[model samples]
Target: MLLIEKPTRPLKLFSLSSNKEIAEKIAQAAGLPLGKVSSRQFSDGEIMINIEESVRGADIFIIQSTNFPVNDHLWELLIMVDACKRASAHTVNVVIPYFGYARQDRIAASREPITAKLVANMLVKAGVDRVVTLDLHTVQVQGFFDIPVDNLFTIPLFAKRYVEAGLVGSDVVVVSPKNSGIKRARSLAEYLDAPIAIIDYSQDDAQREEGYIIGDVAGKKAILIDDILNTGKTFAEAAKIVEREGATEIYAVASHGHLTKGTAEILNAAPIKEIIVTDSVKTDQALPEKLKYISASDLIGEAIVRIHNREALSPLFSYQPDENKDDA
Candidate 1:
């Protein structure tokens, strides 16, 4: 006879209004019902959040991504964390799938506010015990937090897709659309076992002038890696330069698929083969036939499982592309 044993303590998953679909996916993947919540706004534009389910002494994970309407979503996350703390939940973990304001991680100019650090401080102040975020604009932002934080990677998923598409080989080159993404591009390069190429760039009159390719891209397949694809100008310029350098094929990969403001048209006109990104950002229209999106939900779900179990989530950072396939 097989007897099922129940858990001594239950885990509770709460979803903020920020991104309900991804939150629901996480709960379903973990075999748990999403905790109920009622969110509203006052006449004065103040946001309010009320948890409808009991969470006392239970491990709680609140999911909210600070995307567009960034201020509102960020305020919601802060309020939720504070509520969870006062409700006596044993643990309060804030799972921000796409950490926003992450681009302003440092002060490049005098008197400039380090908004990323401010966000970190705000979370800690609002009673977040731990944090789980994916592909931050800068990894150093993790250091701004004193609490435990697991900075997840989207490269493994990208690598898997590339391997499946049979793109890994000596002829492929991973390109960083900007110098800021060189670190991320290098990580992908290491996974594909391919060389790295970088596009030298400078801004002039609100426009970008692509300089030259740092590595040999002549007669090689090219893959550009970035954390986010906003306007697609950087990508367009990089693709043009690589193609002019005699690259046979060009591909793009980003963790957060913001793909905003005519990105589709820009990408369509560019000399690119494929564009891949995760579903962190919701999209109603189907990605262009040339684009492929790999889900980071499983990786995120596994990280949540490990965090709930009090296990180290660091091991998930390493990439292991399968031998039979080579597409991410």
Candidate 2:
């Protein structure tokens, strides 16, 4: 009998147009170079992606965040994945740092489609074997895809950041911008050994209640936490509410900073001293001085390496209030 040992598949990392800066950082952190690929848009607004190198039998990882100009970026990723599939790649894994259309997870009004599910279906149909995303707007969105979906958290990253800054004490308070964000706030609060507060201006189907801050923030330093910072209205309003409640200082923290039109003006004009966000969504727009970005490359890079090695990813998901927090 003849024995032929098949060589192990090679890992190939690629980056699309969106968030390539962080992709480079991820590649550097992973000790891998990004594979060559080119993208262009036709005069008619059609997108074309050309994989410069062969991907035959190679495990491919593509990093893309569908952020501003959402449709264009989404189309680019879908096209790239399809091209990889056609090129006989061994496997195609997608890392979407900022999942677009995730906020449309459900129908709030009549005749509205669940666009988040629709996006999931589209990606799965585009031949993705697995998906890695950061801090999904709704965890339930994972169920929308049949393929394995890993939703990584930014709380641990934020926890480490604040802890190192010596902001982990009783005088610190985690304030949720909305009622729905209380859980996110509470988690960070627990990590920091701080109390949690909620600024709720929820308008029920019947009545509209004015915004109020729950829990004590008087003379406390506030960290307003939210998943995404878009339009900046939520954070701006929440900061004002917290300020009115006698919070001495306010800092805004978010997983992804979309920072759409007028967001800088809004956030800068707010009473916030600074804003901390991850490099999940790369933006070229001139950022404000208050905006400080902590890199997520290390975390996502470690994740990619572990997944490539078929190692368990739970360690990356778990965090505690220990003095030494593990850096991903």
**TM-scores for the candidates:** 0.91, 0.93
Question: Which regions in candidate 2 have their CA more than 4 angstroms from the true location?
Answer: 1-7, 202-209, 319-328
lDDT by residue for model 2 (111-198), tens:
9999999999999999999999999998999999999999989898888888888887889999998888888999899889999998
lDDT of 1 by residue, 18-57 (tens): 7788887777656677999989999998999899988999
Name model 1 segments beyond 4 Å from true: 1-8, 202-208, 283-289, 319-328
Clashes of each: 11, 0
Per-residue lDDT, model 1, residue 163, is 73
Q: Give the whole-model CA lDDT for all candidates, comma-separated.
A: 0.82, 0.88
